[model samples]
Target: MSDSTTSIKTFRYRLYPTRAQEAAMFETLRLTRTLYNAGLEQRREAYRKHGKTLSAYDQQKELTALKEACLEFSGVYSHVLQDVFDRLDKAYKAFFSRVKKGAKRAGFPRFKPATRWDSFKFKQCWNNAKNDWTACGKPVDDGRRISIPKIGNVKIKLHRPLEGKPKSLQIVLDVDQWYAVYTCEVPVQPLPTTGSSVGIDLGTTWFAVTSDGEFIENPRHLGRSLGKLRVQQRTVSRRKKGGNRRKKAVKQVAKTYRKVRRQRLDFQHKTARRLIHEHDLIAHENLQVGNMAQSNLARSILDAGWAGFLFQLAAKAESAGRRVIAVDPRYTSQRCHACGHTGKENRVNQASFRCVQCGHTANADHNAAKNILDRGTSTERGEPLGRAVPSGENGSGVSHAVA
Candidate 1:
């Protein structure tokens, strides 16, 4: 094996800071949010009054004056403060780019409320030559504790071994918990080659149907927790505004949502791993899920989590040296895999499919999976990736070659 790094990945750990350290972390978030807003306001006023544009470098050059004006700003690391301006710059650039494209909603950057600003990042961390980490953040005492710039060493739960050199660190707050996420330049170890291939059909009623007749059932995690969420939401509404009771109720609702999100993510990761491990090449529809979710079946479509599943599948495939191909989804649902006949009437119902021309019948999703496989293989093998050709008299089953 060559001693070379292949990829970069992130590792997250739960942090348990002392009360004082917690206060310091919160202060860092608040100051960063304040700085972000101030920078945004300066740009807006500058543009409105003088018709001048302020670049990130211009704003960054004024950081010294800012620190002198506000004593609290000096407490945080200088690089961290620079990142706040960088974030605002990114937002403005995105806004202008969207406007140039004539987007309907050219989302202008808005002020972030205290509740929304939940994280701060340190851009630099590792030192390779000296084999030493910086003072702003470093793993302490064999990774059990981590030292922050303003805050002392905070206890950490190192769930997994850290790989590669740490590049940057982000301290995130979710609900009441603080997490330290480290992005690293890890070496990738690709799995052994698998000669297998499979095509998948994604649906709301079923999570996925493989070309080999494997049906992965949808868990409907969100639907299962929806009743509890309604109860928590009602509790929040009944509580008085700006009261501790209401805040607590709101947190409860957020916690429930987090639980459901976790469940869905867990399921997707596991399923993606299974497919990547078992197959050398995987194919699925290149669905426009965002557009699809705008219809009346939006709730059901979102609940299926097709986008997340596909993303996870792609990520895992990339890391494992596997192939994931997204084929056109045009007539996969209506086209008959047996005879190349295409018609809406072929879909007998949500679950069944019957070819009117050749009398071959199968599950609707299974037929779609087969067609997806054919499309993927045809494209991969340099053949015309088109609808299946009609075969024998009356358009009987047409055999197609695939590698």
Candidate 2:
């Protein structure tokens, strides 16, 4: 349901660099990691010894001297080294922000290790919007090969042709695989208006409940992959540390977990796309999923992927010209849609709801969803809300049945 507009869209493609190219990229990563650690050390030392804080600009100005002293740094691209300073600057800013917020664990910026530093960004790219080869990492015309600065061109599997003005680019290493991620300015793809509005109640059991009374089943991606994941974890932990066997085992575990993560992302993306297609306005509770995850059901709550789904929905909606409203979540499950009565007695069971004062009853989730929908659409402006199109409505209808 997104309105037509321009938005930044990211595209990911697999990279198949040859052995020599891959080695060059790995060495570049090592150099960047060492530079990052050295920068952090300078910052800490300056503050401790002289009560002086070093800025990214301050440290970056010394790169000329650094390159002369350590000639290996010259082998890396100039912009890449500059971007490392930007990363360090961002990390320090975040660390201070968390400290001011009184976070329990104010994650101070730490030095990077080879394993932790897996991606590097190219801040400078063409503003002209072409996806072809250039100075900063560029993809070729046939979309089969991409060039990395200071490294040779490598074979790329471009599943889809890149479109729009290229903004920024990154080379990321996931486990043993490589991917090229590109951000581009693209026009938003808005779907035909359906006039349907829905309020969704997200849950662990049903995955989602709609005001129209449709229930969606949760796929439980993580729970389903636990068996294989457990076996992989056991193999990794059993292997001797620092050995080739251990490294291989770790990669295996990472790939297995990555599969589960991809599945969850795919599921959420598809689900959000469906809602955006069917509705002009989507209403959902402004749930703090992070806070909710602290309970005993943390694993299940996290596996549900509510936060990711909502974020995706809102983004899609904005792009499509649809509206997504986050309503207050308080008492949505307890409040009765029939007579406005709200109390603990309203919830008869997990799947059933009963209004004690009005003697109105319905499926718990369905009733909650209706209340949520009402709150979202009800306003002083009295603007018309599009009735759900019959062609798109597929709810297994509900009826009153007081127990």
Candidate 3:
């Protein structure tokens, strides 16, 4: 089987650390950042003076020397610092390769400061004594604790019991919050085929309309919380700039925004799981959300969350071994699915569609979903399909198919 068919799962652990532990973690981050910058400097000097390309091993050797030099500043070198250099080397090589292939825009790699050290890594190996699992860094006796090599045991809330052998572990710090990410290789039992398919039409008002006649109302999380958000923003603005009160107010606003984001993500994941469980194949429009978000109706467009919904749907489908097909949206709303009649007169309003030629009336979004389903099925059967047309194009509505 292809690597894509192999089952890999990720579990996130929220770390609860004492004040001293948090300080130590931050110090480790600084040490790693210092090592990374020193490695980058060595590469630049080597390139300029001797025209030598520094490999990861070469940078790692230099990192050891730099760590010794900074012994008085920090303590003994940690494996995390070496891991950071390895990651930077990999990133540099990938960037250059992409540039050479015209896949990435040309740009020079810049140095990262200690304040920006986001994450560090560890590896996991099977342990026979426990006959269960252990994280690469450290194994906590109590299930709630995780051990890292240099960093001692840290408490974590494992929301779910982990399954399978751990392959890698990453300790990431984001917005002053710490998270432990575990990547594992697990055996996946095949899900019983649902033998059903669905085509979804995404919109600004409703999150989605399914060909099966289901409507998922848009949560509008951002819009719903806008009033409170504005109040918080005003509070922050009114505070004396650079003062502790202003800083506290800013953090409060950040927390609110973060809550909304987390809620939206959770909702999307649950919705995707339900759809994936019910459908053998799923079809959705390949919306150019980035471009759409630039339009006058950007706020409403973002509220719809077309991109986020599609991303969740695609990921769930992949993990379930189901197919997700992207069909050109085009005139899906205006085209009559029953008669294949296409015209501007069909879509009478946002909520209603009536085919002028065939006199077939249906809900605007539902008709669009039916058209999407037809297109998806046709494409799966190896039929020729039209491509997507630009939004403002005249009567010619093209549609494109993608896997």
Candidate 4:
């Protein structure tokens, strides 16, 4: 693919490694975690004692000394070891960025225990021309196996054919399972235009409410699995700490949570795909999900996963040559769609919107979606942000199509 038309996309697959390879992977994970923690400590101490900041390169240069001092460090791939420091640097950069924005919680980088350090990246691995994996064993071109340095060829279950050139590989450890995530540079092709447009209202009660009054109900995967999760967690609590039984129980709990996460992710992807397939332009509120999650309905807000859904929507839309706009969310719920009267009384309940001034009533979420649609239309047309048409002003009733 030409550079202008190419985009990067990731595809993940399950990896089945032998017992020895699994042991090696665990050792590598432990060492990587140690390296990350050490890098974090060095940065913290340097700044505290001398008011000096260390770049990733500065810490990376010390890797040779680290390997010389610790035999375990030498066993890990050099690039993989370097990536640990890179991860730390990125975390520190993000923390400072948040601090500059006056965030209440500018999270400091913390040490990662073995359980928390789950993934490592390999920027270059597969060499297609040579039919070899760099610095590792060769991989069969049939997509059945992939070789890794310090580990032998691992079995791969190919669910789909890989397209384009593989650019990077990420080895992920989820609970007790292993996965290889491949990012490839592929050609981006625009889909045929349908000239359709829509605005969406996301909520905990409803997954998505479109401007056309279509409601997608939220699937509370986590809530539904909470009972079983509690049972598994209780089993863990009952077992003696550091015992095999406790470890097994812990894995069970993690597996349950992971299942919930996968279910949520699958739903989000399918929902986003359907929206992008039907509409050429999509609009949604640019919500501060983090701040919203800090409210009284924190659990519900987090479970909604609105941010992740929007992110998926944007990605799909980009690949499909569609536009997804985020409008200002202020007053969207309280503003009277029919009369343009903004009042707290406009939204009498969660589901009902009634304009006190003109006595116009409609589904609260639906009305908000319409206003969002109008704002999006204005934005698309390059009109002033303040311009929005009232519902009855032009005799365009509730049945009017979003486009």
- Number of backbone collisions per candidate, in order? 0, 9, 5, 0
Instruction: Name the better of 1 and 4 by TM-score.
Output: 4
TM-score of each: 0.86, 0.84, 0.79, 0.91
**Cα RMSD to the true fold for all candidates:** 4.2, 7.2, 4.7, 4.5
> Order the candidates by lDDT, highest first — what do you get?
1, 4, 2, 3
lDDT of each: 0.85, 0.81, 0.75, 0.83
lDDT of 3: 0.75
Candidate 1 deviant stretches above 4 angstroms: 1-5, 43-55, 89-106, 128-132, 381-403
| TM-score leader | 4
lDDT of 1 by residue, 57-128 (tens): 899999999889989999998888898888899999989987987766777999999988999998888776
| Model 4 root mean square deviation, Cα atoms | 4.5
Residue pairs in collision within model 4: none
2 or 4, greater by TM-score: 4
Superior by lDDT: candidate 1 or candidate 3: 1
- What does candidate 3 score in Cα RMSD to the true structure? 4.7
TM-score, model 4 to reference: 0.91
